[model samples]
Target: MAIIKLSAIERRRLSAFITCLVVAILAWVFTALSNPYKFTVKQIISFKNAPQKRAFHPLQSDTVNTIVQGSGWQMLFSRMNDDKKVIEVDLHTLENRNYVVLSSQLKQINFKKQINNEIIAVNPDTLFFDFSSRRVKKVPVKLITLLKYQKQFAQSAPVSIKPAFVTISGPAEILSKIDSWETDSVVLNGLNESYNARVKLRPSTEGNLEVLPKSVMVNIPVDEFTEKTLEIPVKLINNHNYYDVKIFPQKVKVTFTTSLTKYPDTNEDVFEAVADLDKWKLGGYSVLPVKLTHIPSYSKIVKVEPRNIDFIVKK
Candidate 1:
């Protein structure tokens, strides 16, 4: 090989060229990263360290204009993942206005590690809440059920819930208004046997409230029913001594359907048929309808024979 060595000046010139190229590359990269960009991203705001007595509502502040700032590349990558990450907002540090200023704590937050880019602005800037100390109350749970059983079968017992009452915690005003909670409507058709179900409790109130146990176990007893008939004597009520009243066919037949188990114990004494004297008019054709009273709650009145009786009034 021919002996060839670059002069010191030539080496210096090559070094400078290399340094300039490196600087230009760095400047280009910096320019690309320094440009400001905006992206709309969803972020979960969690409340932490709240007062033990007061239960805060709305774990997330709100989905408002949440704009994050970063380079074009950072924003592009951030938008790729649709799922949002959560951030904590300390409730203990809330101000007198009960507003949690989210952006104020962003500097101290380890946001860089959590997200792909830095957040420029969290819209709504502040979260306002109507916080109230929770007061727990045990209220009865009513059932909302639609049952259509097979022919001759009906509900034998009252609608039963495992936890007849639920524990609810909310503002004093809301809690005071809630005397009971109700389960979601459960429709059961062609039901022949006893049934059990796990039903969710209906939203008791429209406001912010927390239920300890959201669901309840429901049990409904069902049984076959039998048809029964009873003959009840018709009686006149509030009669004046001035006129005497008499009704043709003094007795009426009351037919009902009752649970098979109760068919034996059911009797005529459970019902009464009466006609009001106030309806009586002298020398006028009066057809008074026989009204049955004291019917048992379990038995359903099918019909009353001799519903209207011909009555004669005398002075």
Candidate 2:
């Protein structure tokens, strides 16, 4: 090619193009350096198989730091591709150093892939945890029974529970604080006879707790009872006008049912039956006075059989 010199205008144009290209390259490098790529670390902690009596708080001392570095574009693309990238961790990796603290820290720290898409690896490999002391406690239990019976039937006494206590075990902080426990109340309204039932234990207070022997067997002592009969005095209201007529069977018989322990002795005349004749008229009429013959201090009547009676009078 023959030697051709560039005109002034052509030289100026070439210079401007070179400067633009250099500026573009410099901008790209600066941008890349400003923002770097990042990755996520995921890990799972393990513990020995043991009965979980109560909920536990994990230890935090042995967490392994996980660090990931990449180009900004690479990190962004990784996060977008797969948010849930699984990271495998070996339990054996956690050797020594407060296991409780490590375990606690592992639990507290939640790791997941960045929303953008990224590759992540959990550092230190294993999670740490602590095995602490636990104990079982014997707690006093109270039983209650709820019963429903026919209208004529009534519950005679308070329901009784057998072996009124149970054993409970859990974390020391939880077990030590609990003083006592109770069961649901037993219903005894309109109960004619005795009954047997099973009740469950309920915690009297709230906290981290575990109850052993969740249920208890309750023995309710109930029996059909009979009441003694007593004869009561009769008062005839119309008897004054019918002086010529005589009344027969002037006394009334009253009977009720009660417990054997509450039965009155033969020598004790604690009950009486009476008849009321306050509104009796004279002409071949019979009148009787009403009276309450039987009364006990400590016992309750199950049923008052034939509570009332009549008397006959003549004019």
Error of 2 at 57 (Å): 5.9
| Candidate 2 wrong stretches, greater than 4 Å | 1-132, 145-152, 184-190, 203-208, 223-257, 260-315
Error of 2 at 41 (Å): 25
lDDT of model 1 at position 278: 70
lDDT of 2 by residue, 55-141 (tens): 333445323445455666655565566454333222332233323333334322334334433334445444444434567788787
Best-performing candidate as measured by lDDT: 1
Q: Relative to the true structure, how large is the alpha-carbon lDDT of every model? A: 0.76, 0.53
What is the RMSD, in Å, between candidate 1 and the native fold over all Cα? 12.8
Q: Model 1 misses residue 28 by how many Å?
A: 23
Report the Cα RMSD per candidate.
12.8, 18.7
